[model samples]
Target chain A: MIKLKILLNKLTPGDTLTFFATREQVDNTCAPFSSNGYQVAWDQEAENRYLVRISK
Target chain B: MEDSANYSSTFFFCTPLSHERIIWCTECIASGAGITPEQGRIFTVFLTGDALFSFVDATSRESWNALSKVPSVQIVADGDELRLHGLCVSVARAAPGICITERGGGTLFWEQLISHLAAEWKGTKKAAFLLCHPPYMSRIPVHMLRFLSGAYAAGLSPELYAYLDGLHNIHNGQRPSEFENIGRAIATLARKSGESGKDPWFAACSRCATARGYFQMNPGTGYCEPASSIDEITIRPLKEILSRFPGFYPILSHTSGGIVNPDRSRDQDTRPRLIIFITNPPYGTEWTFGGLSLALATAMEGIPTTVVFIEHGVYSLYGTHEVPPNDKVFNVQEMVAATLDIPSLCYLVHAPSLERRGIGVEEHLIGIREVQNNDLAQILWDHDYSATRILFF
Candidate 1:
């Protein structure tokens, strides 16, 4: 989750970072990004996979 | 973090398990607009889902073989040892457009595309997406809403064209016990866009809506009125979609449950031009019908459009076809002929596809410019990397 945050922190204000992760990873990542006023959204791609997007 | 300004933009590619699908991806990546290793685009290709094990499959070996030739494509595993006959999985281009690494675990393609929209929406300040799936039954409606939400959060106006069964999304008073309330979400977004003075435009096809019972004849006005749908949507004729297209940049549409756009660029083109490739036969499925519908619709609206019939799609233009009275299929050849009259629509038939299928130019529809395989590659490269979008059906 920290690695995901690090990945997202690199983006500019209008940049959206898309990564493949698990549900837990997305759930843990969303609050940090959203609290910072960045937009985060995700959808389940498969049974175990979730595609997460966070925009800064 | 690499400076976002330095690189054109980031792109993600997700492929399904089918070898043919992977072959398409390989072709796109190997082609000019795909990777552009010499260019500044950052690509993270996800081979997750059923495609994760594609490297080991016998039928997919050829596809992977083609992917290996692409510059900077790598499959990293076990101390960075390149596996799968020295062919790697995933294509990631780092700074200066040199390094390539296959990130092992990743999300699906649609998620990646939705994520990429932020960067895509930045230049346009407006994004238009086609919603053909009805709500509740398919998760695509939810996904579309998520995409719109993300775009809205980034300050981009969203335009939704509910066509086909997509008209079901705008139906009023949707209350799902276990799933997201798509209708309410759409209304909220519409309200927000209206508040922002962005001229919120959420339109559904009147023809389709009336067919789907979303529109009814009211005796008082003697006109078709929206019924059982949220107030945020306006039912309009299908041709009106053309006007909406020019007003937005980077229009996107997908087949059911899938995402298709591959390249996202920093250079933005406000001109809404479309290139639709028909690679399937006319009567086997709805692909030809749908592709031609969009081609005619957009061209009628005067957006410069090109329709290329490649692979089996060349079959669409070959010979005269007669669907028997009992058979429900429309003669796709007639559909191809209908577009010939549209001045703005240009039709191209792949020369190699014809040769492979033993089809001659004289045997097919007239007015189609025959494009060589190499030239087709060049045309695709030019459109895909810039503001123009290339769609495959």
Candidate 2:
């Protein structure tokens, strides 16, 4: 799968994320407290290929 | 039944974005006038792309039914403390867990919300069918709905993981999801029939209704008989049910919430992690020896031992208050030292329980990892798949 590292400083709280058109084409959603990906408050892996999370 | 004073209650503006949505309140302050949406006097909960579920939890049945039918994002003025039950969550939010005790409009824990905006993965026929005519539950079961709701609220698909992490510890080994099913059954039956059971979910409930022992306890005594009550279905937290009838409990497996146990690969390794969870304190009698000897035996067998202290078990790691004792049972410190002296053996203490009991990490024997209660599942589940056998004391 295509993996991308996000800088915490650039991201804002309450921002939703949807990763489409990458090599994997899977949704990468992450929200709540992203302790720079340290403490995962919300990480939902949907049955459909995408990892359900906030994509902005 | 109509009181003008009652109209002025806390209306929770539930939404997916708490920080951003609060800006709407700021807009109201800026305009100095009540800005009305199409629904008029409504709470707009902004959606985070493709949400799949939403529900309402109110104190009054009338308020519940009214809000349940409202298809719009806005919740019309209802009664006091009308909670806008949207999946209010932020990924990577740096808050140390939701303040569970906080109860007010626009404020709720993540797990308490479910997804209702399913726009992306609605390609399948089954997915589309389920999304249409979503069941508007009048009553929300807090414990039953926590995990699934939290999963969806945090923008995760609940279908992938049908399990509530920490609740299984109380249900005689039954998963929290299982307990939630029973609660949902009561909720469903209540929605279907006006009569619903209003007590602890079930007293000694059989794992299944038609078939017995859906949740088996012991070899012979497996079936749990229902309580002699009047209602068709009842609801209560699994934790509450466990406390009310302090009897046998399901052998709950832990998994630090959604994060799976990390000990599976250790199966091929030479040593296995032997986790000893002790809930009872040492009474200085033969009672303490059961766990003590069991721990000693495993360590003697050369298995990598990791003793976990929880509840009253924190006392297991506590230092003596008085002078040195002459009793043989007090050999706890000595035996623990010997066990720890082994290269692989170690100990873990639940930090919350330790703090509750007023036991400091320094007060105990040197060299033990003090972790949060969330780590219990990972610590236990890791060993569960491996060769190490867990013994409770």
Candidate 3:
């Protein structure tokens, strides 16, 4: 299991986030976050940027 | 301003289709005297939204026609060439190219056409280009105009910065009709070209580029003041905080050398004296309010002042106000809507925003007012107050 640090200064509900990660580890990493109620909005294949919505 | 000036003006024809839109290409030539189909061959370049059709001479026409079938083509034309030069579609395409790229949507296509002609044409002296559209259009967006001006600079042989300075001609009048012409021209150019030069609003800023004085956005990074020099002052908002202050008179100044001073010297004065500045300034460089410069001047004498900056969608207020959450966030359009209706003694302080981008807190203060939910006069009053501040950033 790999841990990633998230910066949350100006993060808002509708805003998007960008990050880099390997294709194989994406689904495994997202399962726990999703189960905890976080929603995955967009996963950019080329740039590896992800947009997620956090529950208010 | 003169018909003969059109001959020396450089012309650029931007279309979405590489060769398909021959009708528009012909129209551009006919508008300018020098362009004849026999002598002027049509060059079509494909770009986003639609096709760009340019007319040039034999050699360039052959090159232009070769790429007629390609996708995303942008065409450039020289004075002597009857054919057009086909360039990559996305080369300079963005806000700067909005005038040239977005013609189908009916932005100011004609103004940009003339600006292109002015940029490309050659003579012993500078010539004016007449931008023509299909006809029957009302208003054009200022941003589009800015985009076109920047695009014309990108396509021409000479440096665009100098060309833009000449076209703006800001030295002569504080408010010049050429500003409108340049605005119109820039809008047309952006529709033809897909590229948005340096910034989305670069051309608009370029019009005031030669104006003397420094305009600093980030403060410490240094300022963008030209050598020409103009009076510089900080803008503050007085209405929101200082409205309660007795004997506080607001003044508006103008470039025309006049002062607007409202009388608030009367004892027990219940009426708020509002003085609005409205005037036109020359196109090149100095920061002058579009129609509000005059109003400021009219109110300058014996009146305490609050300055407002309005341009594009941004607004800022100067003088006194509670600190807003964000200093840079403001909506001039909404503020104008609110200030126009209130009957309180209103003084419209008109000034150009020193910064090219974003509205500051000070500009918003002078232009905006809060009204209780249902009062119509308050709404209308607020709207009037905001509308009184002219935009010429």
lDDT of 3 by residue, B1-393 (tens): 012221111222232223322432333323322233232222222122122233232223443443332222224322111112343233223112222333233333433443433332211011111111111121212222333343345443111111112223212223334335433343334343335332221111221232322222334433233332221211111111122222222111111011111121222432223322222122222223322322222222212223232232122243333436775422223333332322332433222222433334454354443221122112212221111111112
Give the true-contact fraction for every prediction, in order. 0.00, 0.00, 0.00
Report, for every candidate in turn, its global Cα lDDT versus the true structure: 0.60, 0.32, 0.27
Q: How would the docking of model 3 be graded?
A: incorrect
List the lowest-lDDT window of 10 residues for candidate 1 chain B: B1-10
Residue B226: error of model 2 in Å?
43
What is the C-alpha lDDT profile of model 2 across B89-124, one tens digit per residue? 321122112122234332243222222222111111
- What is the lDDT for B172 in model 3? 22
lDDT of 3 by residue, A31-52 (tens): 3343333454435455433443
* Candidate 2 structure quality by residue, lDDT tens digits, A1-56: 10122232234665654442211122111321232232333333543333334322
Best by TM-score: 1
Docking class of 1: incorrect
Give stretches of model 1 more than 4 Å off: A1-56, B1-17, B33-36, B39-122, B195-199, B255-269, B279-286, B310-315, B325-330, B350-373, B383-386
TM-scores of all candidate predictions against the true structure:
0.63, 0.28, 0.18
TM-score of chain B of each: 0.70, 0.31, 0.20
Task: Return the lDDT, model 3, position B281.
Answer: 24
Candidate 2 Cα outliers beyond 4 Å, as residue runs? A1-56, B1-272, B284-287, B321-328, B362-366, B381-388
